[model samples]
Target: MPRTSEPWRKPPKAWKHEPGRPAPGRTHEQTDRRHPIGTRAHEGLRQASQGTRTLRTGPPHPMSTPFETLTALRDEWQALQPLSAENEARLWKKLRLWWNYHSNHIEGNTLTYGETELLLLHDRTTGNHSHREYLEMKAHDVGIEHARTLAADKSRLLTEGDIRDLNKIILKEPFWKAAETADGQPTRKEIIPGQYKTTPNNVRLPQGDIFFFASVEDTPPRMAELAAWMRRELDSPTLHPVAFAAKLHHDFVRIHPFDDGNGRVARLLVNYVLLRSGYLPLIVRTEDKANYLTALRLADAGEIGALVEYFQSLAAQSLEWGIKAARGESIEEPSDVEKEVQIFVRGQKSGDPGPPPRTPTQVRELILHGVEPFFRILDQKLATLSPLFAETGKPDIASVAQKIGLLLRSTAASPDYRWEKRFDFFGYTGKADAPFDFSTTIQVAFEPADYRICCDGNVLKSLRYDEMLTKEQSEHLAASILKAAFER
Candidate 1:
């Protein structure tokens, strides 16, 4: 090798600049692809790529377009496809059972989740209910299977045939059933499966007027048009799947195409659209029936924004539940402890006005006191399950677990923790630091204005203005959060 006298050229030092300056890399123009050039920008990019940023970006805000909001939810759900596949069969069975119970219950099927699960999973039924309810539950499962089978083939479109089939499955070869007429006379009505109404069916309005749907002759064509619209929207890249599903649901109900089973089939088709489009099926909780109907009525009157928003919100909830389940995290919905505590506190305040309203400071102190017992109880529970955390062999984790238990319990108990606010108090506010991760904060509060309970920065529940929380509600919410922490 000829020894050229050229000095050894060193690899240019990684152009390190002074602190707080941009790193030596691409030019500003090049880095402007998205974020600005700096440590902060890099940190954001890192968090975004790893999805940590999304932890705070929950269901799309109401101000955003429904399509956009639902698309974000769908993206999150689609991202979990890998984890969902791990135990797809088992997860799906659970989801299907839940969907059946809620959907049917919303339409007056009258079966509990536990009962539905028992029947579907073990072919056994429990509790005291009409045999008709049991039959309806079984029939709903059939409808679910029909929808899922149809959904598996993406090329298939929502059709009059599909809707009729779903309705047939729901009604299960219907026969005459006892019913009531608008005249307050009890009677028996012919029940037909897979057919449009031959007689007039109407809903009573708040002002004592009957609202009729598409007439018997109009039902078939209206249904055909609805199916056509769904197909067109399904092909639209700009149309979010949840919106597509919701519109299908709304329009179907307005048509009242079937003599009966309109609501059940409408719900089934909604799930069909969702499942076909690679999203998790959702349940409009029976607990939320009033709101659900109100949303539908609004949608029927050319005001679909609220209904669309509602469905998108449900999709987001479904995404969260699926992700948690897939990740082996707790997927339980927190109970409404805020209402329970509010009722008790309100009763106390009304009966005895001796103690003045609580200051924020006093409110905070009482919440701590209420949770102290919870922490002690949780500690004993965790002790029995020590191996779960002890296996990590991180004393810090065990300690953090205890701290998290307190935070979870405190936040849950906050609503019921003796309130002493200044105004004719509507609700309470709570805050706690997550164990080990002091940077991570947890907050919960009741927003009386919206009748919503927000926990850990997410809206966990929506209650009626006068709703009261119960012990079962408070304990259920506390247990879910505590189990997640202890397992974590």
Candidate 2:
């Protein structure tokens, strides 16, 4: 690593470090090594993590070095924080699209940036691609949301389990990919989501050298070490978060714990670190991949500065975008225009046939086919049981009068959208004789596009109605609800 990765100035008058004394906020109160965020690749550095270091707190000249530039932009953005509040909604939307595109793009997800944006921003899918591919993109978006949620929890520290959960979320479900054994015979590997690779996952270099990551057996401990180091480092203010995030990313890549999606997870972990540290989640554009990989290889050969600078540059790009957005400047780039043109041109070429604009009729059809049967089954069961309760069950199994209404929400050309209906069965059967002596409200409901069964105020079964919920599904759901009632 180059010295520039940790630029410092003389200690400021307002702060001082005593050799035997702990740094003001630095605690020796051992953070749970598994504090939910670490792998143990570098535990040796934990002791030295508390060493005294100076941070550059002064202003920087315009167009200076990466460190100075980052500091200056960070301060500038910080000052604009109040006014930038409005910009965040738009910026976050753009970022979610950007982060999803580049992260998956680097891993050969075939969705164009435009398709990704539409799929995410509009909940509409276009493009001629494999259903699995589209699902992967959506799943990746979900994985990002998961990471963001985890980062938002101030009580969370990184953990091996969290990282595994992230891998599971991004991959969603596992399938098989063709592979070869050491003997070079063709074979297939099953990728179980959330599980580490059972076999060695290595890559062949252009020059025929096999570049290997931590072995399958070595993965768990190393991941634990890395998580440990990350949580410990997070408490130290010495390393710029960009560098910390970059190093963590590199270490994760080296571990390559999972059977697949390691790169994507590493990128996500980078954002997790950044976001949790109050920094912007960056987009490592797919176009810069060659330079990015080279930086990683260079870091592998002991020149970590290249990697640090590379990530610093990316962090700078995100910061620059923020600074521009905060200043109310047009943050549009040529690529943004190109992406729009691409989507428009694609549609114009032969008319992009998207899913027929969602109709209320479709929503209604779901209710009729998917939801109505379940409600009917529940109602019939309640009526059947009414005689057992007799005088005790006061209401005697009255079903709600099937009130269907259009809610105040609309989307995708469906003005009379948002279909919802509820069927509730309420009764009081006391003295432990009728229906286990309980007063309860069980509702089979369809809110907007979701079909759910509720007991009291809790949802017992929920599903989104894109396709008709089959009779089998409805019957099974009703049976499950009745079975639960009998048990209680």
Q: Which candidate should be chosen as best, given TM-score against the real structure?
A: 2
Best by lDDT: 2
Cα misplacement distance, residue 155 of candidate 1 (Å): 2.5
State the lDDT of candidate 2 residue by residue for 367-472, as single tens digits: 5565666567766665554554433332222222233324322344433332223333345354554443444566555444345566656554544433345555
- CA shift at 74, candidate 1, in angstroms? 2.4
lDDT of each: 0.55, 0.64
The positional error of residue 423 in candidate 2, measured at the CA in angstroms, is 73
Counted clashes in each candidate structure: 5, 17
Residue 283 accuracy (lDDT) in model 2? 85
Cα lDDT tens digits, model 1, 1-488, are 23221111111123244323544675642333222223333333233223343311233434233344555666766776777454565567657876887788666665545456667876865545788788888988888888888999866666778778888888887788667676857778888888777866776775677788878887776666666656654543223456556656776777787767888888888888788877788778765655576667666655555676677678777776776777676654433234335434534543333223323433334334433333344344334433322132212222433444455455653433221111011111223242222111123333322133333443433333233333343343445434434333
